[model samples]
Each structure stands twice: as structure tokens, then as C-alpha cells.
Target: MHNDALCNFWTSTLGERPPARPRLTAHLQADVAIVGAGFTGLWTAYYLKRLSPALNIVVLEAERVGHGASGRNGGWVVGNLAGLERHIGGLSLDERRLCCGVVADNVDELGGVLAREGIDADFHKGGAIYAAARYRDQVAIQRGYLQHLHDLGHRETDCCWLDAGQLAEKARFRDGYGGIYHRQVATVNPARLVTGLAECAERLGVTIHEHSRAEILERRKVSTGEGSVEAPTIVCATEGYADGFHDFKRHVLPVQSLVVATEPLSESVWQEIGMAERPAFSDASRLINYGHRTADGRIVFGARGSYRLGARSKADQAIGEAAMRMRRDLLVDLLPALEGVRITHGWGGSLGLSRNFRPHAILDRRHGLATAGGYAGEGVAASHLFGRTLADMILERDTELARMPWAFADASHRQLIKRWEIEPLRWLAAQAITFSYAGEEALMRRGKPLPLIKPALQRMNDYFASVIE
Candidate 1:
């Protein structure tokens, strides 16, 4: 069990890269300046350049393009929002569906764009499946989720419920009960997608400066370690890396998510596991475990991991031996056939979590700053829609995309009640939640009744919701 902790599977798969572009040394001016060359920044650049070919755009990155979560994510292009209806309860059902439809269409648009641009990221619209592998999972699916689909006014076929036998056709979980499948999700080679988008942006005349760290961001200006960019409008697209800048501290939280990839498996093993369509999958666990079949015949599985106690945790190495072993065990537990499979890669990255839990897109014309992110763990497709929406707002295009709920410019008031408890208490609460979830899962295996943990969590969630309202 040699521990190779520092490398990311996605980047390693790309193997050998060209030298980075020269860092921004001299001061520069542009029509719009973007900080961070990850998906949010790259997508914003792509859309902006597409809308107005003559616009001068500059994207400055702290490292190489796609060096952040954009390259390390689980690769699911899901249509659901991070917060669900809790954040959008005020919108009419038609508006809510339209919002979700836009996100879903963005996934399809991404695939179309990739094909049109000739970027082979192995995009697959294989949809997503949630298996009920425990008593808690069964309850959530049989009780909570079915009603959730109904309340959302989705047709039965839109999110079909599957029994254990039907689920076996896709993937076999050790303790499979029944689950729900939604067909709007897609998967991709996240690193390839981001880098390809960056390439497209550059081709459209956008200037990209690698290793250019934006140290401070002010109205219409971004100062970096090597140089500064002055523009009429600036975009702070640094998501999880937002902590160091005090201006964005209260707006987002950097939570770590870890993943492990198995060595290539033979055809027989895949026959037993059964994801012929390459649908992304997860159990109905509150802790949120996710997996998908790779085009290279690997089963990449992951889950949220322990978080840093401080508010300013950066690219901290995440594949501790314990966490790696735990993730591997989780994969094995889901599919018992993989007990002996060699774990090829174990890695993790941080995601930007917001107070309300929904992704946000705000362009403050007064401050000349536009921001988009806080996807929690669902950023892949959302970033594209968000980028396009930001571009529409910037170009003053009166399109339907700009009319989405999150397209507003300010959220300071709504974020007030979201001010979480300070350090120790916050850390303690998170640990308690994690431990309680573990205990519940343990009890679930024995077919025990639901525990107090569920209601306790619900009450806490309800309290927060009420307070926020």
C-alpha cells in the first residue's frame, strides 16, 4: 500500500504539459479582468468572448489553468441545485422548473459545445442513480425522495424509482434495497473539459496569464504578486480559494471532498458491477458518497471528508492514510467484488460552500465586481450557466438567463443569519454530525428503527431555515 498522496489522477492522466505562459509582470488594462483560471473564470471568459468578440478579456491564475477544484471534482453535471427548494421556496413552480431546466440544458449545451469545438473530453449523458444500501437510505428514498419528486411536479418517469433487481441492471450494491434515478445528469473528464474551455477562450482572443496570483481585488482593479490589471469590470471567480481575500471570507466556506480511483478492472468484474451506460451513482447517505464508471474502465468513488478547523484552509494535502483507507473500504462495501482491486489514485480538493447552500451569481455594477460560485459539490454544469448569466448581465443582454433567481447583485442581508458559529463550536458541530451519521449507518445495518439523530439534524436544519427567513 504505497501512499501516493500528492498527485491528482485527472492531471496525471493528461501526462506531460507544455510550459506555463509568462506570468503577468507589467501592468495591463482590459475590458474585463478575471481572477482564477479554473472553470468559473474560464467559462466566464469563453462566454464573454463569444458574446462580444471584440471585448478585451484577461484571466489571471494563481497557478496553471484547471489547477483547482475544476480539475479534481467528481465530474457529475447534475441539474439539481445545492440547496434544493429550501433556498428557492419563493419561486413559483413554473419558475423553479425553468430554473432547473436551464441548469439541465447547460449540461447538454456543454456536450454540444465540446463536440462543436472538437474537444474530446469523453462526455457522457449517462444520468445518475442513488442506491438504497441501508435502512436510512431506504427510508430516505421510499419516504422522503418520492414525495420530493412529486412536490417538484416531476413525472414518474422523470425520476423513476427502481427496485433492487432493476438497480442490479445498472450496478450492484451489497445492501441494495431500492432507489431513484434521474436522467438529466452527465459525466465528463473534468480536467479535460476545463483545459479545453481555457483553450477555446484563448483562441477567442482572451489573454491568460499562468502563475499570476491575484493578491488583492478592488473596484475595477486586481493587484497580483507580479503585476496589476485595471479594467472597467473585474470578476472574482476564485471559488474555494476565496478565503485568503478578506472581502469574500463571510460569503463562502471551503469544504474538502476526497476521491479514490481503482486500477483498471477486467470485463468480468465490470459485468458483475454493471454500469454499462456509465451512470454516476451514490448511496442515499446524508454524508454524500458519489461514484461513476470511467471511460478507461475505472471505478472512481468519493465522499466529503473531514474539514479544516480554521476558516482559511488552503490546498492542504487530503489523502491521509486513514482517509484513503476509509474511502477504499467504502468502495468495497458498495461493491463486494472489488475487495482486491488496487487503488491507483487517492486525492481530494476543496469546494466552495455558501451560507444558503445554493450557488450564487451576482454582478454588482456599483462595485464593478461580478462573482459566481458556491456550488457546494455540484459545480460542473452550474458554472457554465452561471458564467453565461454573468456575461449576459455584463453585456446588458436582456435574456431569460439573466432573470434567474440568483442573478441579483447583493446578498448581504440574506447572508446575515447564515453567519455560522465561530471555530471550535462549528468544528464540534461538524464532527458531531459526522459521528452521528456513522452511528446511524451502523444501526441501519441491523435493521434497527430510525434514531434520534435524524430528527435532531432536521430540527437544526429547520432552525437555521427559520432564522434565515
Candidate 2:
């Protein structure tokens, strides 16, 4: 997709956008020129400013600030790794466990970072819930949830299993068995967060240039629209919209996801349908439905990897129907207490999906040419995590936090799906999954279950695109 950077789910609704200082129209020199004014770029500049108050830093963006998937995504800031577990087949169990700890730690650290900086992006710390709808999903949750946690030796956490009665009381859902609730997830107005960091960066002497698309780059010179920037180091923070970057093309596939927001329902709406035991909640599905209620009582909901990221995808057309359907059906499916509330706004965003699912990258090819992307769908945490690391690496400042398990090297995939065709194949795969699920449901209705292809389907989802329910 062209990414349509303007139609951000979070930014569009905001009353005002941050003032654009100006675009980089002339040659400039800086200690670092961070590209892409999203979470990664902003944070890189923010942390760099924190480290050296006098460091000359300039951020270059192709569009307005927070225009990428960073500001245009579901507000869920999950502790789960972006593409972490997918690489486990090649890692020792202990190694995987350590990596998982890093993700969990990233979750905690972000809270502190936001708090310490006194930046309020409407961040809510009430945590999240992972709901189970059907028996198939329940079994998968039961099998994977606890074991994965134990293998990683993660934080002490418990799953609150609600019985049919308790489920009825906790969340006003339509129909289901029971569900699992995992705590410690958060939601925020991501646009505010990104803009706040940019403001802080500028206050600390870092310059940000918006609407300055970086077309080409070298170790010292980053080519942009009107002119180019010469810096000691060049950091690329562009995620799924890696159209012009050859190295990032294979590792990450741009996925278009849909989201919608409703006009504030009544108090009964929040008390009844919009309530989550842990505040934020998601279902156990390949193309998952994720949502949380805002402090203002509006429900902001989204789906991941639901479409391919390209101008040719149907995601744009799907938003209206998707919003209506999600509100009418899925809302009732999860909570039946309130079904008729109207959805006022509907939108979609593109995400940078990684092959391995883990989002982290740092490079300095020459003296200083670095890059980072592949947030998968968890850029909220990964973007902050890697942005700090990328900045530290650029300055040659060493810290345990900067020493991530993975770095942006020559990560590429030969069998990678092309961007132009990504959406069609992705939509096809989505239909296939729907058919598979329907077939399974039908056969199970007929007392004939395959039982074998479920894992294979999950593997495809884990490795490919999770575009189906």
C-alpha cells in the first residue's frame, strides 16, 4: 500500500497534530540522522538526547510524525514478543526463555520510560485479557499458554478461568465456554506518545524534518526530497513501509490491518459490553480481534494481518463492513450485553511483519549506516526497545540493555512474497483459513474431525500471515 500515512486510526481523531517544524530542504550536518518519524525514529532521537544533551540529532520523515503503523494501530501494548517464539525451532529452550524474558522486560521498561519522562499518552496500566471462544481455541490456549510461560520462566502470573456463569458476569459476551484472562497489558493514544517524544527531542536540540521522504542513503549522506542530510550516522527506522529499502524487503512483509472506533456509548455500554476483566482483551485466533476501552469510554478495536499491505489490497474497502460486522457480531460474540451501539469511525493501518516475528534491528554498515524494523504487530514495545538500542549503538555507548540478542544484519528471505502480490495471496490464505475452520466445524458437526492439520495451519499462520479468524 502507499501506506496512506494520513489515515491513522489514533492520529485522525486527535484534535490537533503537532506543529511541523519544516521539511529538510537543504543540506544539513548532524551527529545522527534518524529516518522515519515513527516510534523507532522518535525514540532513537529521544534516547540520544537523553544520553548527550549536546549531540546534534536530526530526524527525517517521509510524512508527518507518527504517520506509520506506529500511530495508526490498535492501542494494545502487549508484553508478548513480536517475532520471538518463531525462532525457537533453531534455539535451545533456555535461550528462547531468556529471549522471552527480554520481551516481558521490555513491557515493564516502557511503563517506566513513559512515566519517568512524564509523558501521558492516555496510557492505561490495567493490563489485558486473552479470551477463548471455542473448544478448539481453548485447547490451544491450555496447551500453549502455561507451557510457554514455564519454559521461559516469566513473571509470576495466573490465568483467571471464568466458568459459564462467571464469564456471563465478567464480560457481557454473546456465547462461549469460558475464557482466560492475562494481566499486565496496556493501551495508549499512540499518536500522543510519538508526538510527545518528538517534542521532547526537539527541546533537547534534536531537529525533526517531516514530509521529507528519504529516497536513498549512504554512510554519511541520506538523500531526501529537496536536499540530503549528511551525518556521522544514519539510522533507518522505517518498518513495514520498507518499499525503497532492499535489505528490509525480505525480512518484513507489510500487512494491512483494520480498526474501528465507535462514538461513546452510554455508561451502561462500558459497564456491560466494553468491560474487560483485565482492561485490554484479545481472542485466540490467527487473525485476532483485539480491543480495549478508552478512558473516554470509546471502544477502539483492530485486527492483525487481516490483509496484505499494498495499494491494491481490499483493506480499504473492508474497513466499513469490517467495522459494522465487528460491532454487530464480534462485539456481541465477546459480549452480548450491548449489541446496538453505533460505530462512528472505521480505519485500517499497515504493519511491518517479520519472518521470525521478533522486531529488532541495528546496523552500521560503514562508519554509521544502521537500520531497524519488523515490529510484526507489537511495535508499541519493540519500537521503543530497538530505538534505544540503535541509538546507543550509533554513539558507541555500551550497555546491557543495548546488547540485544538480535541485531539488524543481512537478514533476508529468498522465498519472500512480493509487496504488490502480498495482499492477494494473503487474502486467499485468509479465505483458505476460513474454509479450513468452517470445514473443521462442519466435520466436527458430523463427528469427523481431521485433528491433524490444525498445527500445520498454525505453523502457516506463525510463519506466513495470520489473516483469518
Candidate 3:
């Protein structure tokens, strides 16, 4: 099957689009040349034009807009930070608070933009719930939630812990002991959001060229097969597709995440699930998981999936049937009432995993380069801030967004995920780690002691701890 068919449920419902914008056929000069047409690139262009209308901006896209993770994501516009204090470890409480505030504001800011721009992406800021179904998850989430507040020096009102009764008001997850509720998260049809942003950018006079793949990007040039773009400033916004370019292949590793969507459910089904407001939900597991209620009344869930051998992020539409079944089983475990629901769609996309695991937006005026990515599947809301901050930095403004931790962070740090090992060993290690996680999660589900994988889990935990420290 064509990936375009499996890429997104949001796009599948949009009928057919008008033909894509013309490909670049002649060398062009612009004040800014962006290399990707996804959220990061479009958001940056939108802000730059809004900041200075006369600035010439051109966006080159290897594929159509939102063809990557931006469109294929679980549609949760959340405020969760990709890497908390670990990404900015030495920062004081004041600095951490500022970062958290920016993230929270980003969600609201995106809503405002959608309203003012006359774009309807089915956005609903109903918030999210983190379920702790198992006893182990319950204890872990409690500690993590308290530490989260403590780390930010935030009061209890910022985020509230819900008892089982309170959690019942939010969701009806099976075996749910407790949960955390934050009122800032939102859900949107991401494909509509990205495509709408592209249209808005065009209306604002930013030129977009699809199918213009940049084979070579230099100090003041981006050479594509069809044409070239010459500009003093260039931005690389190609997130998970960064490996396609020589300059970025080594710095970013693309890891795949898979998602499945069920057929539209009846109103009674939703009432039984208690997700009337459609708040995004996920459990407390190291292997990441997330889900949201779609606008069409379907439940879409996703999680970390089988990594490719050697971490290669190519177009592999075959996301093993076993992996898909496991994810479906997990969804049922969370909400047992959905056991009989039919799964209508299944797909996968890659997220850029940076060397240091931090979502970075850096402006190197000396090199005439500015880039932002490695979002680790949290880019929906973060990309908006990243784009605005990168624009501010390029404009030499001393705005609060520009001064945020990730805005100007160092990108040279090395971490375990970033270290490139030889093929078979790297592949083997990934398999072993994933197997251990599954075994551990199964044990936790059974209410059995996690002794079998405790040592392995501890070693893994210790390695990440050492890196953060």
C-alpha cells in the first residue's frame, strides 16, 4: 500500500487537495531560505513575515507539506517538555520556570493563531490525563508528578493529582488507580493544521516550492536537483528526514513511532469511556505511549515501535503486524470497553532524536544558519515556540522566547542514543532493550515483582541518570 494512504487519517478525510505548489525551477534569492515545509518551517516563515512583511522567504520541500511526523502524529498539542531539567540541567528554578511557561503559552498561542487566521483544524483545548493503571505505575507517577512540580518550584494548582474517583470524571480506564490532569493540552487535526498554515503563509507572501529536494546545503546556498536557492540565511527544518543531508545525518537519528486508529464509535461508547471532552490520555511507561479522541469520534493511539536495523529512517511502510497487534492490545488494556471496536487505520512516522535528546533551535549568525528539530515526538506545540524563537534570534531581538533554554543551547553534547555503533551490535542492543521493556511491563501488569528485568532496567536508568548528572 502507498504510504500516502496509511500516512494519516486526517488527510484521508480531506477528500483531495488542489495540486501542490510548483517545484523550484530557477535559482532564487531570498532573505531566508527554509529547507522543510512542515510545522517548524511554516511556523518560522509565518512569524518572520509577520515580524517583517518585506523580508523575502522561500520554503523548499522534499515532499508535500505535513507528509512527515507533523501530519502523522497522534494530534495532541501538548505542553510536555521533551527533556526537562536533563536538557538544561544547570539551570536555576527561575530558568526552568521560564521554559515551562513558554511551553504552556505555546499551546494557547497556537489556538489564537488558528482563530485569527480563519483556519479550522478541529482544535479543542480540553486538556490531558496521565493514567497510572498498575500499582507500579501509580507509585512511579506520583513520585514523578511531585518531583515535576518541585523541579519547577510550582504550586499544586499548576497540575493536580487525581484520586481514582476524580480520575473517573476524566477517564474510565481499566485498573486506573490514579492520574495527573493538566488543563493546558489540546487536540487538533494535525494534517489540517499544517496544510492550513501552508495556505496562510502563501497568503502572507511566502513562496513555497514542493518537490524541491535540497541535495546540497552550503553557507549561502541550497542546491536542489531542479534548482538552487541563494541566501545569506538558511534554516534546516527537516526534523526526522535530516539524515538525507550530509551535514545533518550524523547529528540526528530518526526513530520510528507507530499509531493506530479505530473506526468511529457511537456516542454511547464515548460516554462509557468517559472521554466526553476528548482529553488526550497515556499511561506511565518508559516506552512512550499516547492517544487522543479524533474529531470524527475515533480513538487514535500510538507508541514507540520496532526500531529499524542501524536506526535507518527510510520509507518502510511495513510496521510489523505483531507490533500493531501489541499496540491494539495495549489500547484495549487501557479501555476494555473498546475490545470489539474495529481498527480502521495503522501507520508509522519517524521523530528526530538528537544527540543530547533536547529539542534545539539554534541561530548561528556567524555561519548564517539557524535550525530547530530533534523534538522526539513532542513537536506539535513545541515547534510553534521553536519557530518564533528562531525568528527572534535571527532578527537579533532580546525577547523572552529567544532567551529560553533550548533556544540557544549547545548542540555538541553526546549521549547513549547518539553514539553510533556498528550495525549488528546496534541492532541487537535495540532489540534487547525493547524486549526487556516489554517483559518488565508485562510483569508490572500481572502485579508480579519486576525482579527479572530489574538489573537491566536499573543499568539503563543509571546510564541516563549519569548523562543527566
Candidate 4:
């Protein structure tokens, strides 16, 4: 087995690693076959067993459980979806409210599941603070975001603007220029959550085969190197780790994201940092920086990552020293109290970004296929919601989750999802977007009066966001 400690801080918290599960060595038959035993697969297996105990289900993973983004994420259980407007932008206000409420309530639902399963994953729901820290221009950017959230159907109680004082009371960012206080966000140890969920699904009679990479996938069968499983329904939950295994990678490509955890801070340092509620926090940067106070008194932080050429997925856990240093610098910039803190762990993993930017749960009954993913880095909570939705759709249950805008039952993914552009085009577009965003951040940091350049660059970025996101 791979060294879990070297993977990330979260797996190191698991103490000694559990015994490895047996890989698939013989053909088997089941009612459903799930690919990739990550959050989406495990959650779907758990829900399917709960809703129908008689159904025989099997899950196959390329590595150990939570080997992908499920085990390596920054652990933010955001209530909102990435690129949510794409899904419900044209819906009525009441319809949009229903969808938003479903997502917002998912955070609490996940917490409840953890409690019921007796999983001590350090689940906390102190909310999140999207602060406009650093330069003065960020305040306008954040305010515009809060307005956009409201326009997208978030309730005032669910997401409210915090003045500078209120923001400081929540999180002591350097400038703390007032931002949005979203009440529905929470954090968890993603590694623990995924491992515990896998065990829970096993207890419910879901067979899982670790180190069983699906080399071939057909309408009713998924084959690993030595064995295959034939089922009435097949689920491809590989997400960002698809790695050209199937056409899923074409619709949902992998983007690399890295994270680092600081050593446990002193009480005095905590006091200076001011996250008494342990709310997740992030500055207003398109580069997408976010972090939270861990239960062990450390700050677990990460930022937006990049896409690799050919859409390759990250295989190793270790990140480069320069990348770790960059994240450390960003963390210290957000909270100057951590100027000399030690960064004990750094790791990178791939996350899925769909062509449409929004997430989906699709079940094609005619093809005996079901899949749920493209979370765009919000898969921690989005996976649970979509997993449950997939279970409902597969079971043909007439439920609200199955009727949501993101759920599709009658169409194949190839028909509903657009394929990504070919190699150099995809790579070039990603590079252009990254460079443009970095340029905008550079201008923000200058804090000067280049009115024409700043606004023009901002407008260009807005166009880019509209097109890509």
C-alpha cells in the first residue's frame, strides 16, 4: 500500500492504516457496479443499500479508498455549487429557491449522516467568511459576489454581508474589508469521511474491491485486469481521476489542486487569528484561496490549481517545495500572525471540471449506466447530494432530488454533456485563463490608478468567466 502519511495530513490523522481490501480476481455478478470507490461511489453504494437492502452492489477502486480528491481535498463542505447559475439561471424564483434550499440543507444532512454512522471526522458547522482582505478593490468584488448570490436565490439568513468589524470578529484577515458570511458552509477531515463511509457501505453489504482499476467498461460490465463484474446498472464515478479510462474524462477533465497544513498553533496564535467559531475563510481573489481552522488547532489552507496538458491526472501525493512555499506565503499574507508557523504537510490531487461548469447526476436506463460528478472542486458536499440523486434515479424513485435541474434520467451523458476541445486547444485555453487571472491579481496588488488597464482587464476576465464558467 502507498504510504498514507506521505499523501496528506488528513490520512496521517488516521493513525495506522487499515488492512487492504482484496482486489477483484474473479468475475462476479451484481445488481449494480460502481467505478472508483471515492465519495461519489461510496455515497451511492451506501444510499442504494439503505433504500434497497436486497440489491447486490459492488464498488471498484484504482487505489485505496479516498485515493483521489475524496481523500486529498481541503475539506470545505460548501452549501453552494460551483457554476450554479448555469443550472438554475433561467428557472423561476420559487423553483430556484427549492434547488438552493436542497443544496444548503445538504451540509446539515451530511453532518447528520456522520453522526448516525458514529464517524468522528471533526465535523463542524460554524459557517464561512468570504472576506475582502488585502487591497481596497476587493471590497467591491466581494459585494458584487454577494449580490450575485442573492440574485441566484440564496436567502438573506443563509448568506449575509458582514461589515469590517463583523468580519474581524469572525476571522482576522489582514485588511478585513467586509465580505459575505455564508451560514451554510462547514469543514471536515475528508480522508476520515471517505474511509468511514466506505466501511459503513460495507456494513450495508456493498462489496468493494480496492486496487482494482477498471480497464474496460461496457454497457453492463466493468472489467479490471483479472476480473469483471456484470450488473444491470453500471456507474462511472471516477470524476477527475478518470485518466482516459472511459469517455467520462472528455466531459469532465482533471485540474490539479494542492493544499498545505500548518502545525498546531498556540492558543495565543489562535487568539490573534480569531476563528473562535472555526469558520472557513477565503480572500477575494479569482485565484481562489480558502482555508479553515482545523479541530486540532491548525490552519488547513489551499488555493486554485492548474490544469495539466493532455488532461492527465496527478498520480502522486507529494507537491513540489516551491508550490508549498507559495501556499505558505499566501496563508501568511492572509493572517500575518502565522508568519513563522511551520507547514507540516503538502499534497496535490486532481479535481473534475466539466465543460458546462455545473455538476450533474445522470442515469441512462436504456444503457444501464449512471454517473454523478463534475463538481468543479465542490465535490465534497456536491458528491453526497449527487450520489443520493443517482441512487434515486437508478431506483426509479419519484423523489424531489431526482427531479432537480441537474438530474437527468432519460438521456445519455454523450448526448447531454459536450465534449472538451482537443489537446493543445484545451491546454492553451487553460494557460490563457490562468495568465489573465494572475495579471488581474497583480494589478489588484499594485493598488494604483491605472484605471483603463484595470477595468479593461477586469472586463476581459468577466468575459472569460462568462464563457468558461
Q: Rate the local accuracy (lDDT) of all candidates.
A: 0.79, 0.66, 0.79, 0.91
- Between candidates 1 and 2, name the one with more favorable lDDT: 1
Q: Can you tell me which runs of candidate 2 are displaced by over 4 Å?
A: 1-9, 86-98, 134-137, 158-170, 274-278, 305-318, 322-328, 408-469
Residue 395 lDDT, candidate 1, scale 0-100: 91
Higher-scoring candidate on TM-score, 1 or 4: 4
Query: How good is model 2 by TM-score?
Result: 0.83
User: Hey, what RMSD does candidate 2 come out at?
Assistant: 4.4
Over the stretch 1-469, how does candidate 3's per-residue lDDT look in tens digits?
3556554577786677889889999999999999999999999999999999999999999878887788778888887667655555577877767677778768899999999999889999988888786545455656576577557644355567888899888889887788878777899988889999999999999999998888997887898998999998899898888877765766677788988888999888888898888899988776779999988899989998755775677564435567678789989988998988887777787888765666778876666778888787888898898999888887888898877767773232232225445578656866776766665566667675666566576467447434421
Q: For residues 1-469, could you state the per-residue lDDT of candidate 4 as single tens digits?
A: 2354764999999988878899999999999999999999999999999999999999999889999999989999999999888889999999998889999999999999999999888999989998888988999999999999888998889999999998888888888889999999999999999999999999999999999999998889999999999999999999998875657778889999999999999999988989999999988888888899999999999987899999999898888888899999999998999998999999888998888787899998888988888898899999999999999999999999999999999789998778899989999999999999999999999999797999999999999888776
Give the Cα-based TM-score of candidate 4 against the true structure. Answer: 0.98
TM-score of 3: 0.93
Kindly list the per-residue Cα lDDT of model 1 for residues 1-469, writing each as its tens digit. Answer: 2322234667667766788988999899899999989888888899999999999999999888887789888889886766656545677877767666676577788889899988778799998887786554464645567677646644455578888788788778787777888887899988888888888888999999999989988889999887999998899898888887876866677788988888999999998888999999998666789999999999888998766787654463347677778989988988998989998788887888776676778887887888888788888888888898889988988899888777765433233315555788767866876776665566566664456865565556446434322
Q: Which candidate is the best by lDDT?
A: 4
Enumerate residue pairs that collide in model 3: none
Q: How do the candidates rank by lDDT, highest first?
A: 4, 3, 1, 2
* Candidate 2 lDDT, 1-469, residue by residue in tens: 1324333446655666557769888998888888888898888888888888888888888878877777767887776654454444367766765666776667678888788888778877766656565444554554466566555544556344556566555565554555655554678888778877777778778888888988986757899869888887788787777767665554556677777776676876666563644377766654467888877777777765444424222323235564556544665556655567677566675777655455566565454677776666778877877777876776677775555566543332222322333556655765676565554434433433456765565465544433221
Point out where model 3 deviates above 4 Å.
135-137, 153-155, 316-320, 409-425, 450-459, 462-469
lDDT score, candidate 2, position 113: 79
